[model samples]
Target chain A: MKTKERSSENKICPLEVAVNSISGKWKVPIVWQINEGKKRPSEFLRGIAKVDRRVLNQQLKEMEQDGILTKVSFNELPPRVEYSLTELGEKLVTILWMLNDWGKLMIPAEED
Target chain B: MKTKERSSENKICPLEVAVNSISGKWKVPIVWQINEGKKRPSEFLRGIAKVDRRVLNQQLKEMEQDGILTKVSFNELPPRVEYSLTELGEKLVTILWMLNDWGKLMIPAEED
Candidate 1:
């Protein structure tokens, strides 16, 4: 058996890298909800069960800047800001679902 | 501000909690590789791009104990060890893919 050498540079497990990338308090849930089709600002605010609007807004902007989300402002009488996952962001939803599913399995259903 | 009270008990962002749960160096990648259909012990060792045999074995065993992977050993001259994702383990793949997708978006392609 020819043993292959592991690369040292990409040493950190990708999930850990993912976790550290969005380590903020609200990004994961925010990303999760956004992927769930809550595109409008108000919808995002209301969709998350426990996050405050202020923190939600803050996290959203940061995500947008981070390229995880794109903020589109439609020009109309009442200015509307629509938040959508970039192609990159959309790709994340599947993973979040897996996480949610795994969490349910790991933790007792009653505790969740 | 109708701030819904955020529970301190589940304070850690779910992703962070997820990260910590499988923080071992090889678990995430191992999980990812396993989720990708590398079920046998030899396949896991060969599939991962860089993991060492010793570390991979150690990590796989740890994950198995953590309820992430299930190992089935068949009675034979050359013991047939088959590994598969437990229900909880299966759920983590989507999240892992999301993390992989996000990594591509966040990190420059050249670096990855």
Candidate 2:
């Protein structure tokens, strides 16, 4: 895949770029599933409760394009494919955990 | 502020919650501005390029609702206000830095 085209500004905010990379509706959950060792599309389909196949595919392709995922297609009888988090993707998972923790603090404690 | 209403599901994904909190167009920029010690609305306006006052106000309100910022009003003749990152908001800054690092990896190296 080609390097992402830089924006018009000579200086780009890496934080914005990072946020944009995972902006898709299903991107976070997709990363979660893949991080959990669910590699194939079918596995991802089952792992993320409400994602449709087409949308899932689109996010997967975008993640691949962004270098967050590495896709391998096995030219076997059924044409098997697998996805894994690239180094960047793994780094994001660590950050995502931090975000999840931040989110938990916002959630109200359960009261009867 | 009232705790955020829980979604339909008995369980909520904290990662999604965290992502949604910062989903607004000017949120990250707003955070960056506040992080850099720009406390007032006018200061944020000057710090974030291309953001209008109205949109900036809306995003600031949402971030406040999400507990990412604390807003205080001083009812003086001049009407003063200030904003600061809460503890949760401070945690987000740490995570944002990590995301920034990850994003830097995706940016193409400059070539002569």
Candidate 3:
């Protein structure tokens, strides 16, 4: 039933697509969290402050669907699942690093 | 009274700060519009689709406060106003271009 990854539009705006891909506040944090080696959902909960399981899972699911993350589930007693960033996700990290640099510019030297 | 620029947190996460700086949907378009030589609000209204004046002004005000844009008012009969990107704003444009390129990768070649 689900042939297309995301909804198709006549005139797709790439910027909008980019913005929509990482729309939620939790997303960037989640991406950074993955890059920082917080793989499992439990690890994510511990790393990111105030994010509940349900919401965290939801964001993770969306990211996976968007091809930014790849999730693996192992059949264990406790059930273990880990997520890794794809090539597309890695490219996003590069952009985010640049954004972090830009964000630093907004901070005054005295403040830092 | 308002001396400080934007709110200062003790531990400023530059990534969070960067994401927060461009939270709204209209901001990227607004930046692009300005770059395309749409200087005034009236011009912005025509350039960006489905954006009302109030919302546009709100986004513009926030961008200006963030130092991404500088607003100028001309003393005339009909009143004239213009907005231009600051050096920082120009920096943002460079990043946005990268984001746009990253965005292109998400689109399938056949679809595009």
Candidate 4:
């Protein structure tokens, strides 16, 4: 019984970890924007309304550290930077698509 | 261009709504417990650590309103109550399973 209980707890951990990893207010939006091919910080600022630079940068850095994003800085006069989804990040996008479909189910409930 | 942008915005809305609905700290854990056949409130409190009665009740009420759960009350000596997943909630479990798989990908990153 103890072993079974521990196994159940272990099963629960990944879902909690997954939710926590993407639980940041701007994290999912940032990932969605990148998946849509908007690569730069400036584009994200424009695409997602009301997210200031500092918070956006913090979320971006966290996602990068989490291996969901790869940040590339180009040496230039203006010092250009771009972010793209890594393999793990791409996998997350596929799951988000499933979530998006599931979310559609709740829209009618939300409207009512 | 404006119409296209509007379409894109609509696409984003459902995922945001979905995230908001389940974003409650104890919501997913509560759902997991129910899905595991632990139906009573007391069972959830014991299974999930650190959740107080008030917060648990609030999350349960919100989920019931959102159509993710159905609450039943039995009239008896002490009034038994139980919660179970609605069809929408079961659908969400399917998506969460996918999310759980995606989360496993990040475990290696998290370990390092």
Per-residue alpha-carbon lDDT of candidate 2 for residues A11-55, written as tens digits (9 for 90 to 100) = 788888898998888999899999998999999998888889999
- Judged by whole-model lDDT over C-alpha atoms, candidate 3 comes out at 0.89
User: Which digits, one per residue and each the tens of the lDDT, describe model 4 over residues A14-45?
Assistant: 78879999999999999999999999999999
- Give the Cα error of residue A24 in candidate 4, in Å: 0.3
Q: How high is the CA lDDT of each candidate model?
A: 0.72, 0.88, 0.89, 0.90
Candidate 1, which segments miss by more than 4 Å at Cα?
A1-16, A109-112, B1-98
Off by over 4 Å in 2: A1-10, B1-10
**Top DockQ hit:** 2
TM-score attained by chain A of model 2 = 0.88
Better of 1 and 3 by DockQ: 3
Model 4, span B1-112: residue lDDT tens: 6856745565548889889899999999999999899999999999999999999999999999999999999998798999999999999899888888887877764331
Tens digits of per-residue lDDT for model 2, B1-57: 334554444368888889999878889888888899899999988888889998988
* True lDDT of residue A42, candidate 2: 97
After the best TM-score superposition of candidate 2, give how far the Cα of residue A20 lies from its true spot, in angstroms.
0.9
Fnat per model, in the order given? 0.41, 0.77, 0.50, 0.66
TM-score against native, each model: 0.51, 0.88, 0.89, 0.87
Ranking by lDDT: 4, 3, 2, 1
Better candidate by TM-score, 2 or 3: 3
Measured with C-alpha atoms, the lDDT of residue B73 in candidate 2 is 97
How far in Å is the alpha carbon of B90 misplaced in model 4?
A: 0.5
